[model samples]
Target: PLKVFNSEQIRNIGVGGHSGSGKTSLMETMLFAMGETTRIGATEQGNTISDYNEDEIERQVSINTSILHGEWKHTKLNMIDTPGFSDFYGDVVSGMRAADFMMIVVSAADGVQVGTERVRQMADRYHLPRFYVINKLDRENVDFDKVYHELRERFGKKLAIAQFPAESGPNFTTVIDVIKQKAYKYAHDKSGKVTEEAIPGNLQSQVNKIRNELVETVAESDDTLLETYFEAGELTEAQLLDGFKSAINRQMIVPVVGVSATANVGVHSLMDFIVEYMPDPTRRPAIEQDGATRKPSDSDPLSALVFKTVSEAHVGELSLVKVFSGILKTGDEVYNPGSSKSERIGQIFLLNGKNKKNIDQLHAGDIGALVKLKSTHTGNTLCQKGKEFELPPIEFPEPLISVAVVAKAKGDEDKIGAGLHTLHEEDPTFLVRYDGELKQTIASGQGELHLD
Candidate 1:
């Protein structure tokens, strides 16, 4: 939100993992480490930026996908913090649609779980490039090496070690970055401040083994690099970076790193890795819908997807959109293919939780919001007024459970019906219908929690 950034300078990252893996906390830690916030908020404390909704505060779980942004190393990272509960998987699917890369967090204490596997499958369906983040390294009885191998066993041999904890549990304050061959020791004060130090002598052999494996994996990703590696016996650090990125982009290798989100340990280093290795929007394939392809570039015609809609207090309805091509500017009338009507674009803003920062325009590959647009809803495609094309709408899973609902008082049926309709628009997985035989309104979703 500081300045208009081009497509290359931006990263639309989606953060997701198993429930209680600290996905929400990891997001807050990154924001705090990057100076977006002064301190990290605990989910139990109910003050984190992403879980700002009322129900989330009471339940201490992320129920909605919140858009957050932070600046790191001169790059704008637009993060989507998604709900981890399976009942809310619809939001995760929608969040993945806007992301260029995925950070799937796994808790060292809990290891890989069902939610983790489910989200991984969703990312695979999108063919997204993702890396594993082993979080909660400071918890007792959590073994970094064991959890890492668990990842390798479950996800295959492509799991390359990017970082390993020097120590786990209570004394976990240091992590060795194998690529950089350096150690980052965070302050015990939970301030996210770190001091660079030399790698410990005790772990030198393990670090060397992992670094060699990483280099070999990178070199094998490209024929030229492989030939050079065989001739030179090794790839330079510069070559390692170049080939590592290519390997990741091609899904030839999936890097894994360790972190303690609660301690704010290694979060900063993870952000650095993302900015350096993850693929930018322009590097990925062009988005094609209905036989029309649109590259992620500023010069392409105006085309953006409305992924989510939030009915904000005192702000009317806000549409969250990710621009695939060209710039979405204020006052530009755009066409909504779903509604078959023209929407007059008005004020545009970048959102961090409930906080909205007024902005003039958003560049390609950037995610932002438009205020009070008529005839536009979630899953709608907005393009140049004369461009009659539509981006593919987000595909969500089917509802798994249904329950009947009745007005608490008579004559409140109209209000409840309107509210349920809006909820369906926001969450496509939540289905509602009137059961004529039962003479009742049946609302369906994934589970009991979803209905509650």
Candidate 2:
């Protein structure tokens, strides 16, 4: 077996926000900062990795979830950048199921908007470990305190500020680390490099105050920590780190970090937090039908759950799978336990936002794609032959909007139907059916705007 370097805790992160909230731009910056891409591609130029679909480029909006992978601090990070519009909420739901944590990016200047509340409620429903990012701090009229207060009021006291912007809006050059009591002033380069510095002179007091609050909130999750904090009035850096991890692990607190994803501000720190704080698949107990607990491990027989399938024009179909136990490799024979049928495994590849790189093997708790598998659909489970287990498929929201598009010419009818089928295969949230009641082919999604 080839040793995998940089193997640490794996956390699938989901990011969602309102349309024009810079979700795509944030993802672009994150990829560029991680060295996944050399040049930071812009949405306006139709070259960003996440916005690869023709529709997304032409409309200048993300229509589907763009899944990407990044490695930070030698730990692999898989992220799904989701569309924020209501019409695309279905895509958001599908993405949420694959993520262990959710990052809700909000426009700092805009405060808590409609989609913020909606996505927050959705994340709560799924019991996902959620963090809020007040993005676009470089923009004018941005109020970090007001936005922070609003989020606290909405998300409750469990909402803690992990990082705060040093300055309010434009001229924002530094951020306060609520846990470390330090400041990071980002250099004005496309590659976001920050000079470690002391907390800004003017904000030192506020920084200390917020750091204390963060420590206290984190300590609330552990009795010993709470007692120590209440009596001693402070927590050491190591204690604060431990307490913060415990708080998030127990879902007792949600950390709010600041970032100008456009300016690449706080992006590296955000990625580091995700790797350091988020729980691995093994930490999450599996839900079983017979009331028995199962955690992903290599000791058990091979088991995998299919969460998505995308059919490329030239590469055929790729099945995005999460291995629950044992090992899966190229050319291994496995059974679709959900279907009670055996199928041959093909080549395995790690998907990087529409780009696929070949890999030989994937272990339990790993996410990757398999090429040309037969008799398996999204939500199906693959395991050793004669071993049967079923994982609940992702529950997507009901379509709230519908649209009917017809071919402009007679011969275009067949092409449109085939194209719709491919689209359905790519995104299960997109439902296509012949509406007998209306005598037209209707496509249903989260909302009208999404359908458009």
After superposition, which runs of candidate 2 have C-alpha atoms over 4 Å from their true positions?
1-7, 403-407, 411-415, 435-439
Candidate 1 global CA lDDT score: 0.90
Off by over 4 Å in 1: none
For model 2, residues 55-127, the per-residue Cα lDDT tens digits are: 8899888877767887777777778778877777767777776777788888887888898988888888778
Task: Name the top lDDT candidate.
Answer: 1
The global Cα lDDT (0 to 1) of model 2 is 0.79
lDDT of 1 by residue, 279-298 (tens): 88888888787788888998
Models 1 onward score TM values of 0.98, 0.92
